[model samples]
Target: MSRTAHVNRTTGETSVDVHLDLDPDTVTVDVSTGVGFYDHMLHQLGKHGGFGLSVRTEGDLHIDAHHTLEDTAIALGSAFAEALGDKRGVVRFADATVPLDEALSRAVVDLSGRPYCVHDEPLEMADTIGGDYPTSMTRHVLESFAHHARICLHVSVLRASNPGQKPDAHHIVESQFKALARALRAATRREGDEIPSTKGVI
Candidate 1:
């Protein structure tokens, strides 16, 4: 069966749409959130996770990127939850560590039908990446995604090669996203026809 979902969300601050497909063979990705760096990160989520995903958003950018970023994540997360359905046969738990140049990050995921997030990163950024995407919003994005997706997620930047120097914000965030993608990919994989939970539901 095809695990797919489409979601549309609109508020006074933003309007967002997301399409998600968990089947690896149907993988494709298209993302536009009016923030270049954010779009790149979303692309990494889909590509590295082996999910077919699409996202489009329109927001009051004249104010800030917060609404756009948060709403996009909310929509994407909802789409993922909807596609996952009862989460039957899924592996349900996974972890991954990814490295990018001087940055190393780890992500752990659980498809527990509960919303929670714990994100930790020590990198200090120059306020914004490319002048539009705020460096601080990275954590907010993950928190919002996890809340809406109803998944337990934990992300941590374990190490940076530049221990005494300013680490590259781009690499730090990118590695986390890559790690998150891999962990989610593994956690959502189909393992059998039975639900992976003691309660017989996920």
Candidate 2:
């Protein structure tokens, strides 16, 4: 069976489309969120997760990137959940730790049909990275994705160092995304033809 889904969402602030294929033999990513940094991050998610994913968005950038980022995450998460269907045969729980230069992050995931997110990071950067992507929206994106996907996700920046200097913002964020991607990929892997939860469904 093919685990794939497509989602299109439109609101007064943004319009977003996402396509997700979880069982692809090779990873392919195409993302355009109008914010360069955000696009880079989404690409990392798809590439590291070993998924065929695409995302496109049009938003009121004249205002800000908040709506664009948040709505795109919601659409992406919805597409992922739709692809999972009944969650049968899935690994259902996984964790990963990833490092990028001086930043190390960890992500844990459970496909429990309940929405929850715990995001902790000690990143100090300018209000925005790449001039348009707001640093504050990092946690918001994770929260929105987890809620819409109905998954329990926890992400933490466990270590970051620059030889007594503050950590690099880009590395910190990228490591978190990489860890999340790896965890999600493992959690969604097909292991056996059975639901993983004791409740008989997830």
Candidate 3:
């Protein structure tokens, strides 16, 4: 079966569209969200996960990036869920640890058709990365994605920065996204022709 999905969402605060193909003939990423850092992160996600993904989002950036980031994640997560369908023949559980420069992050995922998220990070992350993308929104994005995707996700920053140096929000956040991407790639992999859960429906 082809694993692909598209989602379009519009609201008073934002308009978002996402297309995802878990098993694509050619992996590609195209993202435009008006937030440079967030776009870069999404690119990393698609590239590292070895999937084809695209996203276009227009939000009230004059107000903040919260709406755009969260809404985009919602759409992307919905697309992921739709692409997986009934989650048959999937690995269903995986974990990854990634490091970017001095930052190290870990992510664990379970495609158990349950929506839950646990995000842990240092309190001293840089305020923002690309001026418009706030570091705090990272957790919100993960939470929103997990909820919409109906997956159990856990992400943590094992190391924030080099000793005696302040946390680099860019590296910290990038590591988290990379780890999540890798974990998702593994968890979504085709393993066998059976649902991973004992319930036979996940």
Write down the TM-score of every candidate: 0.97, 0.98, 0.99
Clash tally, candidates in order: 0, 0, 0
Q: Write the per-residue lDDT of candidate 3 for residues 1-202, one digit (tens) a residue.
A: 9999999999999999999999988999999999999999999999999999999999999998999999999999999999999999999999999999999999999998889999999988778887889999999999999999999999999999888999988999999999999999999999888988888897
TM-score for candidate 3, residues paired by index: 0.99
Which residue pairs does candidate 3 place in steric collision?
A: none
Runs off by more than 4 Å, candidate 2: none
How many clashing pairs does model 3 include? 0
Candidate with top lDDT is: 3
Off by over 4 Å in 1: none
lDDT of 2 at 80: 85
Expressed as tens digits, the lDDT of each residue in 1-202 for candidate 2 is: 9999999999999999899999998788999989999999999999999999999999999999999999999999899899999999999999999999889999999998999999999856657889999889999999999999999999999987666887788888999999999999999999999989888999
Q: In model 2, how large is the Cα lDDT of residue 43?
A: 96
Across residues 101-174, which tens digit of lDDT does each residue of candidate 1 receive? 98999999999999999999975666888899998999999999999999999999998557577878888889
Q: What is the alpha-carbon lDDT of model 1 when measured against the actual structure?
A: 0.92
Which of 1 and 3 is the better model by lDDT? 3
Show pairs that collide, candidate 1: none
lDDT of each: 0.92, 0.94, 0.95
